[model samples]
Target chain A: MRAPIQRYRNILDFALSSLLRRKGRNLALICVYTLVIFVIASLIFFVQALKREARELLIQAPDMVVQRMVAGRHDPIPTIQAEAIRAIRGVEAVQPRLWGYYYDPVFGGNLTVMAASDQELAVDSVWVGRGVARSMRVNEGDLISLRGYGGQPILFAVQKILPEASELVSSDLVLMSEKDVRALFNFPEGLATDLAVTAGNPRELATIAAKIVELFPDTRPIMKTEILRTYEAIFDWRGGLMVVVLGSAILAFIIFAWDKATGLSAEERKEIGILKSIGWESSDVLLLKFWEGAVVSLTAFLSGVLLAYVHVFFFSASLFEHALKGWSVLFPRYRLVPALDAYQLTVLFFLTVLPYTAATLVPIWRAATVDPDAAMRS
Target chain B: MASSPMRKSTLCLSLIGVQAALFLVMLLHANAQKDRAIHQRLSSGILVRRLGLTDLCLFTEARYTRHPAMADRHAAFQDHPMGLDHFPSGSLLAPPTFPSPHARTHPAVPEHP
Candidate 1:
C-alpha cells in the first residue's frame, strides 16, 4: 500500500546500518574471496600475454618455410630445394637457413643459426639474439667458436647483436651466408635445414604452401600463420591445465563465500525479528542485507584485481619458481603484460560480484518473510 | 523433527563427500607425472619398432651405469641400424648422390648425405 520510493529509501538506510553492525564477518569473507580471485586473474592474464607474444613473433617472420621430417626427427632439406621452392608461383625469393644447437659446456645448450641469403637480411650483415650475445660476452665482429652439428670446430665472427627476440629458443643466433652456415657446421651440400620464402600475397599463403608440398612430397611446407597457430595451441594446452587445477580452488572459495554471506546465528535472527516487530517492514530488512553483500563483494573483487596485476608484473606470477626459472634454464624469465580486453574484464567482474551478492539475499529473504509474531514468541 | 534433523545431517555429509571427491581428483592429477614418463618411454619403444629402426630401449635403471649422462639423458637407441622389417615401408635413407665436402671434417656424422 505504501509508495515504492519510500520503501526503497527505508531499505537503503536499513541495509547500510545492518552491514556496519556486522562488519567483522563481512571483512573475513572479503579476505577469502580476494585471495581466490587474485590467483585466477593472474593466471588468465599471464597465459594471454604468452599467446600474444607467440603470435607477434610468427607475424614478423617470412611468409613460408619448408622443413623436412624423416623418422620423426627434423632433418635439413637439401639446399637444392631452395631452387624448386623459388620456382613456385607467387614465390618472391627463397633463402636457405641453417639451425643447430651447441652444448655450451658451462650451461645448457645454446642455439646458433645462420639465416643465409644471397644478400644480407639486416644492415649489420648478421643478426644475433641479445640473449645469445650477452651470454657469450661478444660484441660485433667478435669471434666465437662452436663445435658444429658435425662435431667439427668452427668459428663465426659476430655481425651485430640483435634485440631480445622471443622467436628463438637459445641465447646465441647468428645470421650469415648459406655458405657461411655450411662452412661453420661442416654440413653436407644437399642438406640445409629449411628454405625461408617471401611471397607476394599473405592471403594466398596456404595455396602456395600446398603447391610446394605437392611438388616435393618429402618436405613439409609451413606458413608464418601456422607457426602462430602452433604456439597458440601449446600455450592453450598449458593454460587449460592451470584452469583444471585452480578450478577446484575457485569452487571451494564460492561455497565458503555463499555460506559466509548467507548464514546468520540464531541469536542474530531473533534480534532482527524483534526489530521487525517493533517497526521494521520485510522490505527494510531485505535491503539492509543486500547492501551488506554488494559492498563486501565489490571491495574484494577490486582489491583482488589490483593484487593480481602486481603478482603478474612484479613477481612474474611466481611462475619463476618451477617451470619458468631456477628450475628449468630453458624457460625464459619475463614479465607478463596484462591484456585487459573488455570482455575478459567484464566476465571476471560479474562472476565474482553477482553470485556472492545474490547468495546473501536468499537467507535474508527467507528470514524476513517469516511472521513477525513467531519471531517474538521464539 | 527427527526427519528434519536427519535430512540436515544428510545434506552436510553430502557436501563433505563432494569436497573429498574433488580433493581426490586433484591429488591424482598432480601425481600423474610418473605415469606420464613411463608412457613416454613405452611410446618411444613402439615408435622405434614401427619405424623399422632397431635400437636398444635401455632402461636407465638396468643398463649403462658407467656413463651417467648417456644413461640418464641420452636414451640408447641410435646404435642399432635400420633394416627391412623394423623400418616402415617409406623410410629410405638414400646414400649421397655426390660426396659432401663437409663430411671430410666430421667423420663421426651419419652417412645419410
Candidate 2:
C-alpha cells in the first residue's frame, strides 16, 4: 500500500511541474473555463433566489380572489356579493377589497393604489412605497394630486413611506384608507375592485371556488396557488431562455476542450516519451494525465462558483439583472439572500467538469500505450 | 529551483484541498445566511398579507403587470380573439388558464327539439 501510494505521489508531482512549465497555455484554458462557469452559475443563483423570495412573499397572500367581469373586461365587483359568498358553506369569510392603478404623468410610471381594512391613515392621507417616494420626489407631509375617475383632481398627503425591508413587494404601492380610495377613483359606494376569500381548510379552496362561480356566473376565482405556480413557471422560462442564449458559448468551450484533449502538443508527447524511457509504467503516465486535468478543472470550478455567489447575493447580479428580472421603471434594487442548492451544483459539475475530465483520459491512454521510441520520433 | 517530488506533490495536493474547503465553507455560509433572512423576511411579509397585496410588484409599468392575477385575459382579444398583445410583459406569461366563462355547448333546451 505504501509503495503504490509513493508511486502515485511522484506521478502527481510530475503532473504539477509539467502543468506549471506550460503555464501560459493552461492559464488560457482555465480562464475560458472559469468564464463559462461564472456566467452559468450566476444565472442559476439569480433565478433560484428570485423564486425563493417570491415564494416567501406569497405566504402572505389571500387564499382566493374573486373578480367580476363585465362584457369580458374586469369590472368593479359589487360589495353586496360578499354576503352571498360568505353564505357558501366552505368559505370562512369574504372581504371586499378596493384597489386600482394610477399612472403618474410626471414620472411616466404606474402606481398601485390599495386600501387596507385596518388602515390608520386619516382621510385624504396615503402611505407610499419607497419606489413611489423616490420617483415622485416626495416624503412624509408632502402632498400629491391625481385626477379622479370623474375627471376631477384629488389631493392626498403622504402619511408615511414604507420601510426598505418591504421594498421588494411594495416598491410601486400606495396604501390609502377605504374612504380615500373610493373618493380618488370615484368608486361607487356599493362596489369593490375584487373579493378576498379565505377558506377553513385549504384543500376545499377548489370546491369553494366552484360554488362561488355557480353563485355568480360572471366572476373568476383565482387561487393563490395558481398565481404562485405562474410565477414559478415565468422565472423558470426566463432562466431557461438565458441558458439557451448562452448555449453557443458553452458549445464553443466544449469544442475547445475536445481539441485540447484529442491533440497533445509535440513537446508533451516527447515529455511522455522521456518519462516512459525513465522506467515510468503506463499506469503512472495515465495517473499523471488524470492529475493534470483534475487540477485545472477543480480550480476553475471553485473560482467560478465563488465569484458567482458574490456577484448575485452581494452585487445583485447586475450583469444579467435586466434580462432575468422583468423590466420596470421603478424596479426595486434589493440584494438577494445568499442561498445555494446542492442539487444544482451537482448538475453543474456533470455538465462542465466531468466531460472535460473524461475526454482527457481516452486520448492520453492511446499516447501512453504507444512505444516510447515511436512516440519520441513522432 | 528543483524541489523534491514529495514536497512538490504535497504542495499541489494542499492547494486543491484548500480550494475544496473554501468552497464548502461558502456553501455553509449561504445556508446560515438564508436561515437568518427567512426569519427577518417572514415578519415583513406579514405586512404584505395584512394589506391584501396579491401580486408581487415585479414591474410597475402596466396594470396587467402590477396585478396579473386580476388581469383581464380578453383585453387583447377586445377586437378579436387573435389580436396581438401590445405589452412586452404580456407575451412572457403563458396564456393564463383563466376560468373565463364559456358559452354552454350543451344547450338547456335541445336544438333538435
Per-candidate TM vs. native?
Answer: 0.66, 0.86
Give the range where candidate 1 chain A is weakest over 10 consecutive residues by summed lDDT: A323-332
TM-score: which candidate is best?
Answer: 2
Candidate 2, residue A85: Cα displacement in angstroms equals 1.1
Candidate 1 segments whose C-alpha is farther than 4 A from its true place: A1-25, A109-112, A116-127, A133-145, A149-159, A164-180, A318-327, A330-338, A376-378, B1-113
For this target, which candidate reaches the highest lDDT against the unseen true structure? 2
lDDT per residue for candidate 2 within A1-378, as digits (tens), equals 899898888788788888889899889999999999999999989889878887888877889999998898888999999999999988887889898887655555678888876547878888888888998788899998776777566788998998777778888888888888888888889999999998999999999999989999999999999878867876787788888889998899888988987689888888888889998888888888888888888889988998898899889998887665444567776777876888999999987788778788887899989999988988
lDDT of 1 by residue, A217-333 (tens): 877776766655655654565566667667897788878887787786676678678878888877777777776676677667666766776677557677423432212222333
DockQ of each: 0.02, 0.25
Q: What is the lDDT of residue A10 in candidate 2?
A: 76
